[model samples]
Target: MVGCPLTWQRVSINETIAPEDVAFIIPGKTTLAEIVARLGAPDEITSPDGRITYTPFGLRMITRTPQVITASYPGAVARYRFLDFKRFRANFTWGLKFIQPVPGIPDDFVFESGGIGTDEFLVVLDSNWIVRQHAFAKHADASRYRPWPFDLEPPDDNQVVSF
Candidate 1:
């Protein structure tokens, strides 16, 4: 009951993938090289045969995943990274927050809290290096800036656009 919340907003990193981008990828028609040209290099590529078996995750490297990408045959997983902090802030909770301004505080202080999110688009390729499967497990969507620290309504932050 002292400081008033000043700002509320979403933050993001990198560029997000669009549905139109996915449209260009055909399971049999889309080749690995074509995807590379359209979406750039993948953040992590997992080979079922273990040619390049290592995959890095965060500060520490993890071997079992990426953007939730995996397949049964010789293929590749392409990950597109996008930054959206506003969406990131909504996904995780920071516990209860002060909705009202402090009665004793002289100046209004904004919650000024938020973080960036990693929006990913993963494309799984087949043995022929053609797109076998893909999805935007994390589709970046609508967001807003609020004065309250906590969202009165659930934020449309974590969307799993599976296809």
Candidate 2:
């Protein structure tokens, strides 16, 4: 059998998104069309049980009709389970390193891989959509975290925290 030589090249992938670029996407006010316009078409769109989901940078925006009803940003907890210490350690170390330069980054924030892949995010919906809920499988890939515009602020000490 003839042998083939293998070569590899190091490629740098730069994502141009700044936190401010997506800051304008308000949970209740931002429409699906606005999202498509600003972020450019999503990588995927899924409609299940009348709810539409758009995944961009692994960020999920669920909607019904053409308006955005809910937006879910990725978080570390979903990506790092208690049992999966390797991922948990990687995510935690990343978080620590991230906070030093970006002091405003929240403790709950996570670094998620962008582009097309099945990753999850912490889903927080408007009060109106409180009834809708999805359960994660025991072995489901935990939510991958992405930095959102709003999460850039240091949480208020007096604000009641809920996850």
Candidate 3:
């Protein structure tokens, strides 16, 4: 099925389909009319430099499994105690226990910045749209963003250095 409920029966029976393919992918360089045909009217329209942008709400489904557990016993338990009043007391017990579906840390977390799908993608743009001066950032180095206040000069010209 192309989709879950409304099975878009165009290409194949069970083959999965990308959401972008159904929503955005056109045969070739598509125009406004083709866009309206494939995807319905846009939520917001913008025209800048004679280029039109049709921004629509992206579809997504969030799923999560709440932590839980299930346990069972093989048989019942019976305890019996006896005191002889001379040496020792005797006790007996029997039972079985089992636990299933242990919970653990989540495999994937969605909170981190620069996440895969969280970033915006610039679609349908010419070569001139390529960025020349991109904002570069050093991820882990704090000094890259903030220079040291003191003048920490490099070693003298001919000074010997040891590791």
Candidate 4:
């Protein structure tokens, strides 16, 4: 039954922005103006304290107001959490045949495997809008053997999983 149609199905997911592009954004060097220019406007912007969040596809960036000051990349600081299985299953597949070797999927379905994970980029600015500190947080549900009938237990929270 393995690799059989009944046991597997094709799935596809599109990222609004590429992970490499996000990596290009330097913590102490990248500026808000440059981010807007490179990535365009964010999905949401919050004022008062000046918090800007961009949600492009699956990537999330939370930063303070624009500033010329050098920003800091605190590295991964937050505790990792497992993503929801339902969402992960919806976006993932279990076979190499389902994957297409190309820059982008032309078809409606974007064949992908593994659970949906959250990668967060955080930036904190000083009162003058200078980048003070920053951090990246990521969490993904563990990939497991899921039968076609979907009879697999959800990821256990007790386990310390990493991707």
Candidate 5:
């Protein structure tokens, strides 16, 4: 028999979201203003890499009565029934600069990352608060890869003082 192309199946693929990553669960009715009033401004705002999201879910209930109870006027035994439903969720990203910054970076040096899908979005804006350029993923095949300026050097202030 002729050899067949190898097939790989991805099983148990899971998406890991950061604990602090803000995800909007309610759309439209909720706005950025409400978020700001409740949770202050984001640490950083990334133009061209912006994102706004919204989601909504609903709950419903149902009741049933037995036919035997219907015959008996006001006072009769009634059977209660209940049914639960799975929660629904919606997600959407509005057009705007990706506003927010993830801390834990050393102040002396800054960290940048490749555009979307290259691990968590950690884009760095220029001094003028404009997006300069997006970094590319180191590994194309994988979902995530390292970005630019991975290594950094500490500033040198070693100069002899004149007496």
Candidate 6:
């Protein structure tokens, strides 16, 4: 029996900065004002040693994990976090109804398959507020809505599971 219909969904938080947009940044040379003009104001600015404090807040559901870094005097950081999900299933139990979900009634619904992909970009500034260092991580296929949520590529020999 066809359990239920399947729907694909996507959700993203904040605009993901493109690689090209930041390519022009030259560490030790790019000034803070130039960086801001090129990429707009950073989401968050902070000084580890009492000079950094800023972050963007929205779409509380999306999760982002960032490493704690303590920068030098009067530094700053720019952070961008984005995530996308796909394939949503609605489980419902029907004793009489066919489509409409009945409240208070537990349904035999299983979200068979879904996927989540996330990306983050971080820019760190030095005491001079110049481009001290930066890093960016993204999934090559973060946008592709593959039917299967799990990894389909050939298994990695190094990534072995233990009992």
Please provide TM-scores, in order, for all candidate models, with all chains considered together: 0.55, 0.26, 0.19, 0.35, 0.17, 0.58
**lDDT value, residue 89 of candidate 2:** 16
What's model 3's TM-score?
A: 0.19
**The 10-residue segment with the lowest total lDDT in model 5:** 75-84
Each model's Cα RMSD: 9.6, 18.6, 29.1, 13.9, 26.1, 7.5
TM-score of model number 5: 0.17
Q: Runs in model 1 with CA error above 4 Å?
A: 1-11, 48-73, 87-108, 113-116, 139-144, 151-163
lDDT of each: 0.57, 0.35, 0.26, 0.41, 0.29, 0.64
Off by over 4 Å in 4: 1-20, 23-29, 46-114, 141-145, 148-163
| Winning candidate number (lDDT) | 6
Ranking by TM-score: 6, 1, 4, 2, 3, 5
lDDT of 3 by residue, 1-163 (tens): 2112211111111122234534543323444444446544333222223232222222212346552323332221111111111111111111111232335633222211111111121233223322212111212221121122334687689978799
Looking at model 5, the pairs that clash are 25-55, 50-97, 50-98
* Residue-wise C-alpha lDDT for candidate 6, range 1-163, written one tens digit per residue: 3444555566666577888978988889887789778777765565645444334332334347664756656666666666666555544343324655767755564444655667767777777778888888776374555554456688777987789
- Poorest 10 consecutive residues of model 3 by lDDT? 77-86
Model 1 over residues 1-163: C-alpha lDDT tens digits?
1222233455455456788877888777888789888777776667645444433222225554564534555565666666565511231222224343445643333354344444677777777788878878663443434435576888788888998
Looking at candidate 3, what is the lDDT of residue 34?
46
How should the candidates be ordered by lDDT, best one leading? 6, 1, 4, 2, 5, 3
Q: Write out the backbone clash pairs for model 6.
A: 44-54, 45-53, 46-52, 46-53, 47-51, 47-52, 91-109, 93-107
The runs of at least 3 residues in candidate 2 whose Cα sits more than 4 Å from the true structure, single-residue gaps closed, are: 1-16, 48-163
- Quote model 6's TM-score: 0.58
* CA error at residue 114 for candidate 5, angstroms: 25
Query: Candidate 1, TM-score vs. the true structure?
Result: 0.55
Supply the global lDDT for candidate 3.
0.26
Please state the error at residue 155 of candidate 4 in Å: 12
lDDT of 1: 0.57
